[model samples]
Target: MLYINQQKSALQASTLADLAEQLALPTQGVALVLNRQLLPRALWAQTPLSTEQDHHIEIFQLVAGG
Candidate 1:
């Protein structure tokens, strides 16, 4: 099971990119924090989530306003 923003998500995804796709989270204005660490966009496709344990994925949205 994957824990996203402290909420459990049943969406099946191995990588951050996949997770974003499944959750409908925009990759352009979002930042991912996996396992309490910042995840680089370059590594999102390569980084794998562990199935043996619950993984924490925090999504931070960046908004622009004037």
Candidate 2:
């Protein structure tokens, strides 16, 4: 049982893409950082996340371009 902090959803997912799907957020609009490392958007679908391991994930919503 992993504990994801500061996250709205309670679903236990291994990847950001799964989390996004559970949270109903677009994968392209959010930025995720794990353990202080910035995860590239291209790797979101494959990057594994662990809440029990004390991962620091920073999520930012991207604004549409003008």
Q: Give all candidates' CA lDDT scores.
A: 0.84, 0.66
lDDT of 2 by residue, 1-66 (tens): 333445544567888777667767664667666666777778778987776565555667778999
In order, how many clashes per candidate? Answer: 0, 0
Give the worst 10-residue stretch by lDDT in candidate 1: 18-27
- Model 1 TM-score relative to the real fold: 0.83
Stretches of candidate 1 off by over 4 Å are 63-66
